[model samples]
Target: MKPIYKRIVLKLSGEALAGEKGLGIDTNTIMRIAKEVKTIQKMGVEIAIVVGGGNFWRGVSAKEMDRTTSDHMGMLGTVMNALALQDALEKLDVITRVQSAIDMKQIAEPYIRRRAIRHLEKKRIVIFAAGTGNPYFSTDTTAALRAAEIEAQVILVGKKGVDGIYDSDPKLNRLAKKFETLNYIDILNLGLKIMDSTATSLCMDNKIPLVVFGIDEPNNIIDVINGKKIGTHVKED
Candidate 1:
């Protein structure tokens, strides 16, 4: 199937990479995701990924720790995830590059907008790490920022468990209704938990469309890009 968007930023939560274990990277899970990514890459779509570090660390969870320190540690965790994902993709013969906001020159290239775009133009997958090199910001915000900088057509968010954006937490309330499509203002006003307010606002201001969907099912990424409509699409109404 043909991909609807020429370029996209895939926002993956660290928990999604952790799979059922709920912590740390799951080999089988990452491999499965890598294979799926390969499929889409072969479809001639430029892919940039912003992976979270929640599997390794979450600043908010460390209530007693200094917020900045905890957040910095969280950023390092993202770099680790980026390397693992880069390895998995390379093993599949997909050329991938890891760009870190917090530079580790020996391991990854520093975040450079033009270089990233050039990599995408060359059909190389670029994985962004380190959460904007700032404390208190989330990987979701990083995705929005990078997408806006790279001028991507859409942000495809692969959520860990839930299928799409709901009126309330589906796990907590089974009766919660799912929204197939929503506007940016609706997300802001209703305060959906899909992405942080800062990230949501950035997407809105830039007019970037987003698709929030479940990552559990195989081929969900491919399905979303092929326009099967398996997720909640957010855009300007």
Candidate 2:
């Protein structure tokens, strides 16, 4: 089936890449994700990915370290994840590029809006790493920012465990309600933890639609791009 959006930004957390171990990259898990990505790429979709580095480091969790230093470390972790993902995709014969916000010219191209767009237009998968080239901003915000820059039609978020947005923590409350659809204001007013408020506000202001779905299912990404309703949908309306 044809994809609903010609261009999309895929947001992946580092924990998602770690699989059940939740510590470091899992070779098998990354391979599985890479294969899924290949399936979608073959459908002529322009894909840009924003990956988090929680598996390697989390700036917010560093109580004794300087916030800037910790966040910078987190940024480097994202770069590592990006390289691994690039390798996996290349092994599958998929053309891919890693663009780093904090440039290390030897390994990745510096974050260039036009160049990134060009890569997508050429049917290349672009992985964005380093969390917006600044400290404190989460990768979710990076996804929103890049999607706007690239004029992507949607932001598809593949969550590690939970399937969709909930009224409360589903893990803590089994009876928590799942929202099939939500307006941007609802997310803000209700204080849902789907994405940080900065990220949510950015998407809201730019009128970008977001799909939050569980990445555990093999076809979740494909299904989401195909317009299947398997998760919470957030938009202006």
Candidate 3:
């Protein structure tokens, strides 16, 4: 199917790349995600990716440690994931670029809005790294920030545990109501925890659609871009 948006930011959890064991990099999962993104790119959709580092590390995981140090550690983990994704994407014949929020000249380009968009305009997949380059902020917010800055049409969030946004935790409550479609107010009121509040507010303020879906399913990114309606879509009023 044809993609719905000309440009999209695919947000993936670091844990999602860990596969079933939930530790370290999962090659199968990474390859699957790469192929899915490639499918959309083949159909003329410009893809930008923001990968989390929860699998290897997360700032909150080391709550007992100094917040700044822990956050920097988490940011390094994101760079590791970003490099892995860049390798996978390039292997699949997708022209790719990696721009780090924190400068790493040898490894990636520094995050420059115009340069990243230029890469996309030239049909290269841009992978954003380093998670907003700030302590205590999540890669989720990085995705939203980059999406907004790049003027992406939508943020396709591939979740690890849940299929979509629900009033309550679906696992905890079997009868938890899932919304096929939702608005920012629903997320704000329910505190759905789909994306961080910062990320949600960023999208809401910019009118960028956020589609949260299960990443466990193969080709899910392509499925979302293809307009399959496989997950909950959060939008602005």
Candidate 4:
């Protein structure tokens, strides 16, 4: 099937990589994701990833430390996740490059927009780590910012538990309504927390579409790329 999107920014929460343990890297899950990504790579999709650090550290949750320090720690955690993913993808013979928002020359190359785009052009999967290189920003914002920089057609948000965006938390409310498609205004007016307001605003202003889908289902990423409508699509009205 011809892909509807040539390039995509995959937003993966650190918790998604944790599996049942809910903390640290789950090698099996990472490898599984790597294999899934390998399939997409062969489809000729330019893939760029923005991974969260929630599995290791969440800045907002750590009240004892300074917020900036906590956020920096969270960013470092994302770098760890990035390295683990790079290792798994390389094992599958998939060429990968990790670029960090923060300067981490020993591990990842510093994030350079031109270099990142060039990497994607060469069919190398680029994993963007360290949430915007600043505190008070979520990985969701990193995804939005990177997507804009790379000019990705869509952002595929691979969620952990819930399949799609609902009026209420699916895990909390049994009667929550699932939206098939929604505009940015609806997301803001309805107060849906699929992503932070900053990130949502960025996508809205840029007119980039987002697909909120469950990663649990096999081939869901590829399905999204093929425009299968397996999840909630957020776009302009």
RMSD of each: 0.6, 0.6, 1.1, 0.8
**Model 1, CA-based lDDT:** 0.96
For candidate 2, the lDDT comes to 0.95
TM-score of each: 0.99, 0.99, 0.97, 0.98
Model 4: CA > 4 A from native:
none
- What are the lDDT scores of the predictions, listed in order? 0.96, 0.95, 0.89, 0.93
For residue 141, give model 4's deviation from the true position in Å.
Answer: 0.4
Worst 10 residues of 3 by lDDT: 217-226
lDDT of 4: 0.93
lDDT of 3 by residue, 1-237 (tens): 667899999898899989887989988889888888888888999889998999899888796999999999999999999999989888998889989999889999999999999999999999898999999799988988999899999988899888888889899999999889999877888887887888888888889898999999777787787789788988877
Q: Is candidate 1 or candidate 4 better by TM-score?
A: 1
lDDT of 3: 0.89
lDDT of residue 36 for candidate 4: 88
Ranking by lDDT: 1, 2, 4, 3
